[model samples]
Structure formats: C-alpha cells, structure tokens
Target: MRDLYQRLRITPEAEAAEIAAAIERCQHTALKADAATVLQAEWRRAEYDALHDTLSDIGRLRARLGLTHAPYWRAGPADDFSLPPGPPGSRFEEWMQRLNRAARAHNRWRRLRLGWWLATLWLATLAGGVALGHFVLP
Candidate 1:
C-alpha cells in the first residue's frame, strides 16, 4: 500500500483544504491523480486511513520481531513460506469480532475500576469530615 500522505508530502492529519492544495501543487501526474482519487472523498479517505494504519502497525511489528519477510510466521527458507491466494473468509471476520469484544470488555472493566476508586475516596472523605465535626464541636 502506498503512503498517500508521504506521496503528497503532507501529514496524516492534513485537512481537506491542505490535501487539495497539495494535489494542485503536485508535479507528478500519477501521484496527483492517485491522491485526488483517494483523499477527496470522506468515506474512501477514512477506509484508506484505517488500512494504512493497520499495515503500518504490522510493518512495525515485523521489524521489531526480526521477521521482516513474512507475517505471523517465522522467516525460514523461501520455499517454506506460502500465503493464501484469496481474500480472508469467515474466520478472519470472526477473529476481528472477538478482538472487538475483548477490547470493549477491557474498557468496561477499566471504567468500573475507576468508579470504584472514586467511590472509595468519596466515602473516606465523608467519614473524615464526620469524625472531625464530632471531635471539634465537642
């Protein structure tokens, strides 16, 4: 996948006007056309951004793991590696769903834990105030 942001010499956070300006100033016709096609529309741009981020993360992970050749598998003899020729099927979708569920569950747990801590702090403050009032007034 091409990094449109890098191609256009702009940051990922560039605004629509900035992208349009970059497209206008771009000298390469092919790069200009590609950038205009992908970055002009909101939906396409969003999908591109998501895919780009995912690919970039995968690349970083591969580099970190010293497996720059293949993904999710160790780098071995060239003949030992073979990728599926077709698009991912139901199993991929199911795995993504499971991951999403796990993320949501973890977020919910974090919020609940924060709420408990705040409640405990509030109770402690209230108890301290009551005790201070009882002793100081008498």
Candidate 2:
C-alpha cells in the first residue's frame, strides 16, 4: 500500500489544518484531490492509518523472515529451477539451514504468544459472565 502521509509530506499525527496545507502544496492535482478526500474525513483517515499500519507490520515481518522476493503467486513454480550441487559442508547451505531453524523458532514463539492471548481473553470473558450471573441474576 502507498504511504499517504509520505506522499503528502506530512506526519501521520498531523492535524486537519496541516494536512489541508500539505494537500494544497502538493504538485499533482490528482494526488492533492485524493489526499484531501481521504484525509478530510475523520473516519476515513483513521481507517487509512489502520490499513497503513497493518501493511507496514506485514512488510516488516516479511523482511525479518528473509522473504524479500516477490510473493508466491508472482514467483514461478518451485521446480522451475534447481540449486547447483554444493560441497557437503558448504557455508551457504549451513547458513540456509540456520535461517530455516530460526524461522521455525520464530513461528513457534508467535503461535505460543497468540495462544496465550486467546486463553487470557477466554478466561476474562468467562469471569465476566460468572460475575454477571452472580450479581445480576439474583
């Protein structure tokens, strides 16, 4: 996703007036109109910010996982090309193995963290229900 704030040359936290000023100063009339339309509304700006943040997070995750190449759909079949045979103890192979191991470890940690949060949320909901039953039912 395009970074609207960067395009407009304004910070994400910029006020409406600041955004309007930046939009007016934009050289491209189409971009200026688009920015004004999106940024002029409170709710649209909030939605754009959320979408931008999520896309940025995904980008960071991809970089961390060494997935800087085009996505799977853009990349051709896996069997299209094969790696050249290397020595038994090649440094590249060793580095790749280590990277795979680290990626697996990171994935496991993320799953564990997500599970913990889900469990906590479930418990909180259960406790709230019990409290409501105890106090409001009687």
Candidate 3:
C-alpha cells in the first residue's frame, strides 16, 4: 500500500474514492508494478484499520463518559444529565466531572485557536488591500 500511495501521491486522510481516483490517474500516467506499489497497498490497509480502531475507541469512550445521553451529547438542554452527588464527601465523581469539563475546555480552546488564525489571516489580507488602495488612489 505504501508503494501505491507514493505512486498515486496520496495520504491516509484521502477518501477511498480519492485513492481510487489517484490510482487511476497514476495508471494512466504509466506507473509500474513495483515494491513501491506493494508498500502503498500495505499503507492503505493499515490506514483503514487505524481509522476503524480509532473510531471504535472514540465510541467506547463516549459511552463510558455518559456522552451518549441526550443533554451532554446533544444541543438541547433536555438531554443533559445532572451530576450525581457522591457519597459523604468522597470526591471521586466530582473529580471525574472536573476531568470531563477540562477535556471540553481543551476542545473549545482548539476550536477557538483555529478560528483566530483564520480571522487574523482575513484581517491581514483586508488591511493589505486597504493599504494598496491608498497607494494606488494617491
């Protein structure tokens, strides 16, 4: 599979249809049946297996985290679960809830980071254009 990926110049993130298209393009371009092709075949198989495993793991983790329930998993307030009070000052459940909250915070931070990058790029481009216009108009 590694060989195939190289011949097609594709990554694991490429969709199956994209990979197939890439292979077809490579075939039309006269790629050879060689060791590279063998490696690419292996890589593609591994990528698919890895994706499947990761998705499975995420599903299991969500279930364990009680995210499968409505409120936490969905946008509606009706689906939310109230935190269960732990027995007699034991902080186990509270600690777990804190960890979950932290994870969500981290995820939100990542999303905001991406948004900021995009907004900055856009503003820079707009400012550049305004400066260019000023120069041209004068």
Kindly list the per-residue Cα lDDT of model 1 for residues 24-137, writing each as its tens digit: 999989878988999999999999999778776665554443343445443432312222322444445556689999999999999999999999999999999999999999
Best by TM-score: 2
Better of 1 and 2 by TM-score: 2
Please list the residue runs of candidate 1 whose C-alpha ends up more than 4 Å from where it truly belongs after superposition. 67-138
Q: Tens digits of per-residue lDDT for model 2 on 93-121?
A: 57789999999999999999999999999
Which parts of model 3 are misplaced by more than 4 Å? 1-91
> Highest lDDT among the candidates is held by which one?
1
> Against the hidden true structure, what lDDT does model 1 obtain?
0.75
Q: What is the Cα-based TM-score of model 1?
A: 0.47
Query: Candidate 3: lDDT of 23?
Result: 62
All candidates in order of TM-score, best leading: 2, 1, 3
Q: How close is candidate 3 to the true structure, as a TM-score?
A: 0.32
- TM-score on alpha carbons, each prediction: 0.47, 0.49, 0.32
- lDDT against the true structure, per candidate, is 0.75, 0.74, 0.58
lDDT of 2 at 91: 60
Candidate 3: residue 69 Cα off by (Å): 25
